[model samples]
Target: MKLLLFVSLLAAAYAHGDCGGDCLKACRSCTCDLPNDGPSTDDGESPFQIGNKYSGDCKQLICKDHNASLIVDGKIYDRLVCFQGAWHFGYPEFLEEASSAMCLNPGNRTCPDDAEMRYEDDFKCMCKPDFEDMSDVFPDAPEDILPLCTNCGKKKLRITFLIDNSGSMASVIHEIKHFIGQLVKFLKVSETGNNIAVVSSAFSYDVLINWGEQSHDESAIHDAVDSIDADGQSYLATGLEAVKAALVQPTDENTQHKLVVFTDGSIKCGPEALKSLARAANNLEHLKVETFVVATNSRYTTRLHAIANGVEDNVFSISSEEDDEMENLKVAAKLQRRICA
Candidate 1:
């Protein structure tokens, strides 16, 4: 009975020691040094020089001895690691030959012949395996344990303005400029890293502001918006194509993209062409279009809504007689909620 009890306690202790806690998710830096010949002190006479020390969470205190031995303590230890508020020597150390793995941040340091730097966590530098199933999201997991890493991609926002530059829009050009100024101000006040771009639709199309443009210089964008001239025919399809050309799908899996179209008068494209164009635009799963009709004329309202994916909330209209200040305020508020949300 006494022997059985002792064996049970030893097994329990062994099981508890097996918990290595969290492994390091990334590697910061590593170096190796050896001592040189001569009566040199430990200050600068190491044969192999210590490069930058590990600046990651798994920090270590190592001692280089007179015999050019590298270990945690001068001659007694391997590597000292602090785990669970207690220091354990030689238990968990940086993976050997780590340079052969796929290093995420391989700063000028060279790893062993075949080792490479791999992804990081919080414990030690792990190496990429010999073979991995790229389709498997957690391919790095050992057969006994669950996978530790998964990609949680980024989210991005893109805002685009499609404005009409036809002759009839001359009276409201100033109002458009003011609306743009307010929009820029709102973006600045919100402090979200949203992308901004502008497309002018008139006799010929021009992307005055390209996509991925930031809001750093408000004056430059304001000048571009204010410089729009009311001239030529309202070619809505032309402008839409220009916008499509300027757009790029972000590498991340998810994004929020908003395109606001402000146009007056009729589009130059025929019904068949308009229908084709609207279908193509709607097919873009990651992009949503919103229309702001500068006129209440029936000639453009129904057709314009089609371009806006036939969503009523996404379609807004403001006529020449409407109060410009109130209309701008409403539109700006709606935009803030939709784009910045």
Candidate 2:
């Protein structure tokens, strides 16, 4: 009876002002601080609170400071938010909580367990190297019961790279090399064996890009990129088939697979390649993989646009005029996310 009476008194006091007016008993807010977190921005630090915690959506990937960005689907959004003449995301708990959590403590053998802080990004929590602002917070989830949502960060993501390793690619091989190198740098790698599988087919004489490597070590891909020399016919059909096969591996409603084709011209591929692309599209009609084509020149624009996006909803086009090296890397990163499956 004494305990029950004490509990009643505590509840009454809490309602008065202990938790603040309009604050829920759960000590959380239903609305996330807009601009507090999202896809791209610079600083990841902000001083905003709606109820008792963060003021942003957990679905928005958390980044360190405002220097980070977010990759949605296959497109990248940079510096999308502005705050107080600067940029930020969620809050910088590390600097503030790290000390209390003993993360900054030099030799505090025993510390409070509640002091332990979350670094924000899911990949980082798993001890994976930081890249692409991959954190495990389901920001899309409605607030209030947000804690119930699991932000594993990475979802099903499938990406396929179609290349034109013909002689023309030789001229741009260095540029491609730089692009691939930086790709491995900015994109996050899969820690749970979920990564990007690059099924590439080149065109010079016939076509040779698929290594049948369903899932090779991400490390190996950076090395394999060195072998991309120009000399082959543009048989894009063969490449398209390879991508279709890769997309067939995943079996989950969460799967997000994509096929990206990079080519220069239709001189070598001709009608055969077109037929294969069309068939590939038909194959992915109900499958998880959605195809995309990135042709280098206008020669096969019509066919590439047609074949890459059959009946599926999403597709993209990039001009050789604009540097797509980083964009391609983003594609690879998303594909790697799918590969994590």
Candidate 3:
């Protein structure tokens, strides 16, 4: 019995040591310095196809896409990384071959070719960009995690203006109106398939596709927005959910659904409601939803961060306590990109 207990504890220790955590679900960054140029297979039986990483603007940290060495804590290690479906990092195929190994340092210090194991040398690590799935509802992500794209990919964008229409929003409604127009104009000409729509609800906003598929009518959306007079309590969640439901979803060959919620009032929803909203948004593909929260409440910033994820830049606070609501409107107008053509 004593022997069995000892063995059991040993096994448990080994198992605990292997804990990799949850990052293995979709992607994982390798810390080992092994050199192998291969594509990372999805967590499936078939292996991922191997491909070259240096294509166009795509880059691996350092001059090379893969195969870089670094000295960390007096130990040499190689690294591999997977970003955007490409395996940019991996093991090197050969050992040191030069008569003198080059130090990554500016001096390019030379060491014996056989000294791959001799000196404590420092080398640079290769870095590659990370690829993230877009959201259908407002997204919440860290600033550095946002993917870089010179041109919009196959993303379908539908930004809805959800202005707080309760008594608290009356001062900001006109500004919200101008903000919508500016957003619409910026998106219409992008050829990025960026679509614009509007909706209003008591204490929050809703989708105005009142006329069905053709709901993108300019005057109709604007008039419908104007029709909503400020009144009622701030039922922020209801309107957000309503807008989420209204987002177009024929993800067959074209179109993507990205929701942008604009609000200037406090939220009345609790934690559970917020989680449900996040879960609903997380399950959609081809959608990268985000919120551009505009308000004066610093206390509510945390809540906004929770809802928006790492999209903190999306949050804008109007600092002037004495400025008229029109000034806020001007701010909103400029918040939306302006395009003359």
lDDT of each: 0.49, 0.42, 0.43
RMSD (Å) of each candidate, 1 decimal: 20.0, 14.7, 18.1
- Candidate 3 has a TM-score of 0.43
- List residue ranges in candidate 3 displaced over 4 A: 1-156, 189-193, 203-206, 210-216, 248-253, 269-287, 318-341
Give me the runs in candidate 2 sitting further than 4 Å from their true place: 1-153, 156-158, 184-186, 203-216, 246-255, 267-273, 310-341
lDDT of candidate 2 over 76-163, digit per residue (tens): 2321222222222222221111101001112222212112212333211122222223223223322221122111234424444556
Residue 251 in model 2: lDDT:
51
Compute the lDDT for candidate 1: 0.49
Better of 1 and 2 by lDDT: 1
111: Cα error in model 2, Å: 40
What is the descending TM-score order? 1, 2, 3
User: 1-341 in candidate 3: lDDT tens per residue?
Assistant: 64564464345334433333332331232121223222222342222212124232111223122333333223343422333333332332221211111112223433221113322443322112221122211133222222111112223355556666776666766665655553453343223444456666565555655324434455566676666677777766666666556654433334444455555646556887666545543433224455556665566666665555546766665544444443443344334421110
Top-TM-score candidate index: 1
**Residue range with the least summed lDDT across 10 consecutive positions in model 3:** 94-103
lDDT of 3 at 313: 66
